[model samples]
Target chain A: MLPRRLTRPRITLGSPVQLLLLAASFALAAYAGVRLLADDWFGVALWFVGLALLHDLVLLPLYTIADRAIVGGLGAVRRREWTPYVRVPAALSGLLLLVWFPLISGRVDRRYRTATGLQADVFLARWLLVTAVLFGGSALLLALRVRRAAQHRPPAAR
Target chain B: MRDPDAPRLPSSPGFWRSPLRGPWLTSVLGLVLLVGITVLFVTGLVSYAAYNPNLSPVNDKTPDKGILGFYLFAWPTSPHWLYRLNQGVHVTLGITMIPVLLAKLWSVVPRLFALPPARSLAHAVERISLVLLVGGALFEFVTGVLNVQLDYVFPGSFYPLHFYGAWVFFAAFVVHALLKMPTVLRNVRHLREEKNDLVSPRPAEPTVSRRGALGFTGGASLLLFATTAGQNFDGPLRRTALLAPHGGVDPGSGPNGFQINKTAVYAGIDAAETGEDVWRLVVTGRTGTVRLSRTQLAELPQHSGALPIACVEGWSTSDQWWRGVRLRDLAALVGHDDDPPDVFVESLQRRGAFRSAALRANQVADPRSLLALHVNGEELSSDHGYPARIIVPAAPGVLNTKWVTRMTFRGL
Candidate 1:
């Protein structure tokens, strides 16, 4: 278990706070489905369907994969791996999802730029390059550190 | 692979060089699947426009010509395995791909912000594409969520934003693809040169095994599949079961939000039973030839899918379908699937100035696209293309051809 201070920042599954929030949200959605907003059924329906997509389609899988990889495979590489590693996951994931907002909102002409305006394949290629450079740069730095450590070894008393 | 004895590296000092761990793999895979699935929808729209020239912006004004396009655009059909399959790809890919994409972005944040692209057109365009990709991903997730609950909530209208935003979605992916092309090729080349870390191991914590995580992922993904697939089990709710459900413009049979053009020219020739000699579909295009009898047609292998006919005008339906031949498969049967890039379909009507408004190959290649012969359970209805009709999911209605007599395959 992580210390309280650090754990405060991290979201844990099945925690009391998380469970309470989840329970409250579901209760609200159910209530709305049955009682509060029966007439405006379309919106309510959209809300529920949208909720499933948000969680099942995107969030959970992302986090699950991240948690498993970061926590399991490379956890032993650095004592402080959590901080920097999570930073990458946190920022990029948040940003990527954010940018897709207008289109996902189902507002095509009003919000999203038309397809002719944006060449999508090109964008993906550049994004990959950016990611590669980041990982590549990190590896280089680590190799440099290892080399310096070997060179600085003090002579034994022999 | 992991080395139990190796020291654990902290994330703070370096964002790059993280091993392909659970998070990294998940994120990368998620991004790949996410992009690929989104691309499927995008290309679907293009294929729709490509096939039925009536749906073209050039002919948008002539609503009469667009009647066929409308049905092609909006209706859904039965044996909807394609819908389930695409949904499977879309939902599962999004969930898994998002995090990996996130990690990938994180690794490169510094480069993005620092040494910012010069205020040149190239840099500006590049930055803009990135913005679209990031934003598009989020939008896809949220709306996709809304789409799933549509059956329970809205009840009637359950079409995903795929139908409405197809054109724009197409543009977004096109931009992303063009931007990433060079770099992707380079990276892929690099991948070829460097051993896949995914397959091998770095000298770190030996306990870390990608294989283990994969095993778990495989299991969990199966659970996801089972749970999701369970949510939608097809029954006899299709139109075939709705015996004579108000033949006079059955509003329920028509897709949601689609304006029924009550004036469709139902083939005057053989709308009812034709003698066996006339029942056969005639083929006309590049190499002119007419094949007799659907029985001869049925001799070819069949492909079936449960697909929704999505119209740009907003209508869809669910139907189980069994087709004797795919456009590709059919083209090959007539001996053209391999060679000719394009094929044109002809109806029984005489050709006019708009003679070229026929089916094309690009449209059928889409995953949910189909040329159906059966709806509900038995042979297709006379009103609904008795022998053959094209049914493309995510395609506008006009493109789906009813009463397909002949498919001519050629380089044209």
Candidate 2:
């Protein structure tokens, strides 16, 4: 156990300045709430609540499950070190996909083409290419790391 | 690559937590996120103010009845790249911040599940603010990204929702920072000391080192940056911007080769309505309003300068030579010429979010502020606001007031 000196509680969380800031923050939020309510309160409120729950529940779990599957699948092969190398690229690619979902899905093909004066047909292919580059780059880094580690190993240990 | 005699590892629920879930990682990522959020907020405020929403409602012609937008002063016009740079950084930083925001959120995930959610009033308030911070941040980023893509996934209007959400997020950000500063500073200093104390052993977690976590997060941010920043950065980097929604393509060709936010067709503007003979620009002053024919407008002392059309949607075009009467010159046409007052610019288009806009005093006074009649060397295309449009330096594309029909100077 820690000594009494370290165990004693300190007022680290809040103070006068922090309280004042909290007040100001609350005031700002209240003002925004009024503005939001004045303009489509129900719809905006529903979006906010629904989105928050969706992110925390559905999206978080979905990503978590996906990550675990990758970790588990890689772990079974005793390739734990390679998990992050794959995960980072995958996550980044997924985020890019999320940001450009409409174009990739061809849902907004006509609208996008009309607005941007560019073909939406190339989006899916471009995303695929970017994803491939990310994975390829990661694989290269992993290969280099393995080569360096192998070189550093003693002959007897090898 | 494991020892043959070593026992096989068993999957655990806690194994998913990142090794970078410590205070130091949170602090560093939080600091970066703070800087990003601050930049976004500041630029967003400038953009909002530039709208001069206080002068007039975007959707309504009846001024002084809508929201008190503090539209008291006109946004500046000099240093022509002002809006371009602010909006560029606003958008690029927002995109790069995706990874940082994710990492910061992930770093603090464990805290969300902490037992007994609050112990005191302060803790309760902190938790409340945390909810606002997370919710507001998510709302802002998601809506912002979608809006830039012109995807109206949400049901309500974008401007008001986004504007209000910004305040909520900003408030939460301020409070969260205030509450977390001591802890954040302590952790940051602890990290620095650890780096300096070479004799001390490094953190021993083998799943993923702090360096690895930082590397991956930073790499994701950089990748996001490289892929999306071309919307504003242009140049050779533009080709690599695979994710840029509008890759610097100017819809108009030749003398009119400048990117467009709203085309005549898209804006529901009839082609026949914009004929030179039928078009006339009305300029209201202190004493009276003067109507000028297209030919008369052409006869005025025309000034030419290159100016970029920067949009709030985060796409900007290369500078195109614009020729027309200066706004100050137009203001001079009527009495009370010196230090011109705020002017309400009206567009010929029957309906649109930006059919009309309020131009602040500074915008009214700027010499570069033009009631443009021609682009490059040719007459303005119907799509490029034929007859006349207001093109002010550093003003948002929307406020450039396409197909300008009237300008009523609000009393000084």
Candidate 3:
């Protein structure tokens, strides 16, 4: 029912509604971008684009390699079933670090102490303690599972 | 398009080998974000409104808010714990959802590198929106987390930066969600992951099932919640919030043992100025300006209310007993006998944000709202907003101006 030009472009992809909505989204984003850039263009743009690149190119690759290494290392001991136990604890610990790195590293020591009157020094120790507990607890659980599996095994297989 | 024999690029389908990355997984993560992000956005907006941004150029931190302030209304006062509950949920849930967000990103990351960049105009537009969605999410989360930790290395003030970034991000988010919703529903309903680039052509031996990965993410979120939620409470539980800025033991003991966001030294409060003999509470309104000393304020019809100090940074104190004259009574003293208009409160805080703030008329009229003179059966210490302070039910802590020196009720 539509005209030829409209139908032709429409066949390529998306309906008119989709295009309109996308345009609206772009316009809103542009407005916000203008406001943000007006204050701190360099920092805002860097954080906006650079973080994506950093995560995709650098952080993802590093974490993948680390995970691969962990899996490979466990394979040497034929304890590959234990990978989740290690992975779970490590991921959780890494997440805590990611979210609270400023505190855990004491990067904001004087400012934090002055503003809050509490020692930022405590976070580093607390984070370490948490990591230890996670790993220790996971190890304990793995041990129990291994023992239970061993007991369930057939004599011929053993 | 005809050259299928050429060696594959990184963007080629063959490069990605994660067997776990599939539409089913992506859709699952998307569903979680649908709920989580909606809550985050709503609570974030509510937190902004609680500051009563309508009182522009005074309490409004985000200048030129324009149409974005459409939802702005006088934040309520009935619950008293409203701001505390809202902010606690906002910060705690924001932190807890990180694992889910990361996993969701990981699930769809290969799309970020898809070859030819765009096959059609629609596809190109979709991809651009994806960039905004991802970038905005990261920017908002990073800035928020950093601000919570009191790390202000980022350029610009936290208010406008976060406010603008959120709008941009949510705009893209809405588009992306709508475009992808149908696919998500179909993928989830069918419970089948059709073979695509996300599926490895030659997968290695599987280490864990898809369900296991999801469980791990959920467990990580639960752990974060456990560590972060205690900052919203008081007593022994407060120490459990080791990751939060105000999670440690109180600054001191006894009645003054609760958390304080800014110290007297930090706010640059002069001891000489705030002393009882020198301090004077100035009231300006329809009647005219009336200056009253600290003793004069104590002599007024003293009232008390149990209220909490809830900070936007997401830490809150328990309901400490606050005693002083009602704000409406103060308005009455200034000749507003029937209804109080909006009031602007000024503090002697020489430095930092919220040195002065404005309150909504409803907030002014609230019986619980007071010019708090004492907290928890003792005169407030210098660090605890000595001499006098504003205490309005359900208002953000910063807006409750401290070291009060002037109050202009109505017609500002």
Candidate 4:
């Protein structure tokens, strides 16, 4: 049986193994923190915390608003059913942009060329081509589905 | 029952209108990450071990890595494709999993802004651990992605920062996984969605079903894999890896046109010193030192073997026909004729990280290992390690020291 002081707050607090493991996790994080701070403390610390805020406070809101606009704009035209066709392709393209932003934007052009002896300029064109394909493919699928549905309906009901 | 006085928007649990953001969706994504991240961590550790950090100070990039290096052993030499497969999988899979990770975060985001912060002492501790888990994940992924792109915006050297950051992230990740495993199992067992904070109290009409959302995420990951995995191969397929740094066609033409991580010029190799007349292969061991010129090295019987050069940056070249004197042959010249001992190799490059590297005794004895003099049928180009270079099987590209300088055997 555990003592009252330990268990009074919560059952988890009474588990010594859990507490010990938690302490170890904190210690490891601290060691990494100290080593990271030793060199570029300001940059490292800013990136560590700032990235989280950027995702939650900034990127998330921007995307959510964009998604809402898509939904709202389509709903007004009585074509809300077409949202998936637009959303899926947009989400996939946005993800590619997010991952390969540096290359696609040519931000690392000089350094990348010097290091690998290959041009970074190819990325921007390739990304645009890929985005076009995704949207085109999705729109084609939607057209097929719409045509099939119209053909299957009874004339009187239509 | 909905609280009449509940907070507005995101803090109120009513703002997130996705009907699909619930335990089932979160758990499915969690399961994918459970399998995917475990592979990432193991392969990441294997990539570290490939550097042979146990050699200390020479190849060891993470200096204060005390107990963290317990799993590292003398990396193998038999398969020859070992390092190539390890690095290719590590980098390619890491990029492929980004969409899944972002989706998982999006699923559980409401908890990040949960009001009052903590309801109890245990709750507060759990929240703090969540902070470490989230922060550590973003830090590792961002740094790793930036490095692959040749962007060095992040502060400090990539080696120690990544090594240490991995430990912190994995520590919290393991704890978080352990705590959530039971709940995840229970949630995934049933198709029935459970009510929780993740479930929107005022969800809008469903544009996409839960299964549809999962499929979209999986499809996104598949797309990334198609665009990224081609960098590991050769020929026409290599052009498909548009998202990877080495996806473009090889620079220049003909046989020596394949990828090179750094040019001779960029590595600070002085072309004047690397010339056949000035460069000398210095071999030292129990028999004392022997200095041999490039012409003399070619005179001592040449051997040819095909082997790939795999870089830590995750790009690799297909097997180039390398002709040279075997490392074991050189070791024999320095007295250890029967079994070649560990050797320390130095290079003429005046700059960069691994100007010198050490190899284990087994690596020295590998039949394929060479002091390569000619790549393809032609004499070596200045960009491809000029007068002479070390070429060992299944080792990281950096460990294959370039330009002939000196070698010390049996005392590493």
Candidate 5:
């Protein structure tokens, strides 16, 4: 009789569905490659390659370092349950900043105004206010949680 | 010697398991990513198809025949808000996905740097697909965000790069989903059953409950949606959409309220060239070329219709009164106006991606389509394609070619 390992359905190369999906994806990717090559091969390739390098080497490191600082900055409350409250709001604020950096920084102010007839000067102040609110709300929630925990703890445990 | 079955040594905080980071959370966020990306891809494709560019022999020169370019769709004018709905959803959903994407990445980032990197061939394939999915998704979102803001930071043209990138991204996404589906289903089932207190192999203390993590992510997405969705909505919603790129001001606000995609200055159109005496509405059809001055065009039976100008950037104007000569009537002035052959509308502007556009038979046949010379009750403003412009229902903003000077009919 065949051994159990031999009898098992091996998926070292991925299951049938995975294989099919990969094949179809590869076909579409090949079409894209052909199209891009026909257009501007060097420029597109450089942009994509530069993007990968910049993201992995620069952006990823910067965000990772920032995250580590957040975790480490908690001091005695590092072990506390409320740290994620801070982390969530901070991450969200950072995302908004990332998405609207051009507008917030006034880089696109003239262009935006010309195109839409709407001033973009308010973005910076609005973003700052939103960030402040998010953090303030999180701090309040954390404080409330802390108060509730203190109240619930038995005198001996406390 | 190290024992083969020894417990995995605990790693540093950023490199190891945490309560907020686990297969369960990953599965949840991954599901969101899956749904969000699917919607974006489908809607994006619908927008692309609306262009209806005959891709085989893409001709920038002779737009009517022999290799018409990629931007060649006779954008539909019917169901008038078609572009508005598709592009609005496209941009708003794209914005909403930012927080969800960030949370999804945050949940699985440690795994990206997992010890030993990959354990098997299957693992390596999975990782590769993940790279494609993430990279492609990021490229699309980043480019889209930039383009909508009129920021052309990228070197290449926006359309082709974005179009091709989407295909690659969707392909990789399909493969990634296939590889991860089983584990995702298993983890989701476990969560539903409450069979495991923690889904990770290493059960870290519950510093942050899963519910708290999910709530934070959801709240962030909701906040972003609320702030950005106002651009697409009208009236009070616009006031609240403070963060929307083009909120608070309708494109149809003043003397030239219709959204100005490319200004006369931007299109390199000389002010002197657009003057009434200097401008001529040229029509070339089966008979011959005929040049009609602005006075002649004004003399032609002027008709008015209320039409919306929907920009590809996602902001649309309300229906405003537009008056001009019907394109079919103008073709009838020449010959081959019966079958309503394909009409090529050429702009006076010397340069731009949309200097000239080909109007398919359908657009020409639509009586609503006009060479609009007057917007509202006033003569066309220079910024609103003065002298004459093509305004057709259901076409992309660019295809409603502005500053029109010539119309060549390709007899079908």
Candidate 6:
């Protein structure tokens, strides 16, 4: 029998796009940080609110989907998609952050403005820092884990 | 060398035996060099803290690092070999220390993975501080690279993380040192071959395996190589380290507190004042006119002149000038130009929710201070206090009142 067509379900936000959106929120939060250091206290407060939304609503779903997709894709590569995959969210997010920072601004003066502004700057720095730590750390861990796995594997027949 | 708390030389063969003596030797020498560098850096004498950024060894020369006979000039002009050497030394040593720090970290990772003495408050504080230190160090290193990249510009953050965060970092490091003192001393003694009490006479054995141990050493080496080749990522190091130069001047000028930004003597001043003899600061109220209004003088000679206005944030390029009718000229219309004891300037915005310092009338009238007419030889820059301003030099810039709506002098 002929193989079934490779069909995907209709979704409002593309799984990849959802990840993009989540990352964009983080980028926004980072951008807001610029204003905070400039002593624009109002900008700080907005980012916290933005962060809550991004983290809970967008990032969580995006990460969940992306994680599943990767695991699935990894399996599929051995079982289906044959090509190696790369996760490009960090680079994409970094690019988005750089390009759009000047174009957008967190609300200058709201009750939550000061906090949002401060949090935005700090959160961005914190976020970037944390990302670095995670990436650097996990890369090292993954390499070691793979090495360990290979060492444990039985020798292949010539 | 026989100290009381020395590490035993190796007799038993385990995984971590290789790192014992070598790391200790490395640590002792490294720590000495690091401390020496820090002492020279922190103490103002051999200040790398950008001082007199524009002051050149030559007239109008940009300040640079000078040794017994050598001098390092600013970049893109005549590169100073000596200065580059110092910069190179600081960078190289800092990178080299990474391995030492990582190995030190590796040596201690056994204890690190396990929970600290968390039940006690001191233990919790210690644990928390260690987290901050690790996080801060990693950050300083990475962001430092991001900052260095000329092509890949991260947004400029004028907020002084390193400047302010140094204390936090220093505190955490000290705490970590204190907490690890017993073991550190053991390691030091083992390396130095001093004296100590031990269950057996043997060398040190690090907790991490040879392979794992090499992971850290190799990683540090690779990263350092990358950094020297201009590929190391700039992270928090940018914050903690001396900044690169800007506008033909080194950024982060002043070792600790001696930064000279564009905020200058004429920022808020009356440029119309040609002489100190005729200078008068108008404090709104006299004997009866307790709170003066704008309508006090109608037929007065209101003259104006353009003056230069600069602020320190390194943004010395705005045309907004000191634009205000001479205080004395305006004061001659109503109050005496002299014999004024105190001047109280009011901000257009309410003076609450902010830090404030005041100036005496005599201080204001020092003639160095001015109620400027124009900034950069033009009309007032509105963002820079359009109508008028008080220019206080050598005094903190915050004291320079902006958008001066009212000026009042009281004799009492």
Q: What is the interface RMSD of each candidate, in Å?
A: 21.3, 3.4, 1.5, 2.3, 4.1, 19.7
Instruction: Please write out the lDDT profile of model 5 over residues B1-412, one tens digit for every residue.
Output: 2335545443323334456666688888889888998999888877876665652122122223222133445556678778778888888899888778777766665565565555555566666776667777777888888888778886577777777778777888877876778888988888454323233555445556787778878887888788887776556677667666776555566646655677776677788998777888889988888999999898999898888776767766667789999988988888865777878778887776668777778788889889998998898887788878998887777878888988988732
Q: Please, what is the TM-score per model?
A: 0.33, 0.85, 0.95, 0.93, 0.83, 0.34
Candidate 3 local lDDT, B105-196, one digit each (tens) = 88887788777677777888888888899899988888899999999977789999888899999999999899889889988897564666
Expressed as tens digits, the lDDT of each residue in B162-268 for candidate 4 is 78778878888888888788789889997554677899887878988989989988999999999988888878888989778888688768767888787887788
- Looking at model 2 chain B, which ten-residue stretch has the lowest summed lDDT? B195-204
The top-ranked prediction according to TM-score is: 3
How many backbone clashes are present in model 2?
0
Better of 1 and 5 by TM-score: 5
Question: Deviation in angstroms for B412 in model 6?
Answer: 11
For each candidate, report its DockQ versus the true two-chain complex. 0.02, 0.36, 0.65, 0.51, 0.38, 0.02
Query: What is the C-alpha local distance difference test score of candidate 2?
Result: 0.76
Write candidate 6's Cα lDDT for B1-412 as tens digits: 2345543322222222234324454445335434633532232112222222222221111122222113322212112122223333444444445454544443433233343235444444455555545544443333333332211222234223322223333444444444445555676676455432221134442333445444545554454433242211123332222111111122222221111222212233343331224333344544433222323322233344322222222112111233344544433334655654445565453332111224454444444446654555554343344445665433223445665655655532
Model 5 agreement with the true structure over A1-158: per-residue lDDT tens digits = 99899999654654555556666777777666566545667776666656655665577668767765666666455554556777877887887888888888889888777655566688898889889998999889988988998999999994
Please give the interface root mean square deviation for model 3, in Å: 1.5
Q: After superposition, how far is residue B113 of candidate 6 from its true place, in Å?
A: 3.4
Give the 10-residue window scoring lowest on summed lDDT in candidate 3 chain A: A6-15
Candidate 3 per-residue lDDT over residues A1-158, each given as its tens digit: 88777776443675677788999999999987898888779988998998889888887877878888888889888989889888888888888998999999999999998887777799999999999999999999999998999999998995
Span of 10 residues, lowest total lDDT, candidate 4 chain B? B1-10
Chain A only TM-scores, each candidate in turn? 0.42, 0.76, 0.87, 0.86, 0.73, 0.35
Ranking 1 against 5 by lDDT, winner: 5
Q: Is candidate 2 or candidate 4 better by DockQ?
A: 4
Tens-digit per-residue lDDT, B21-110, candidate 1: 423343444445446556556444443433344433322322332222344542233233344344434444444444444444433333
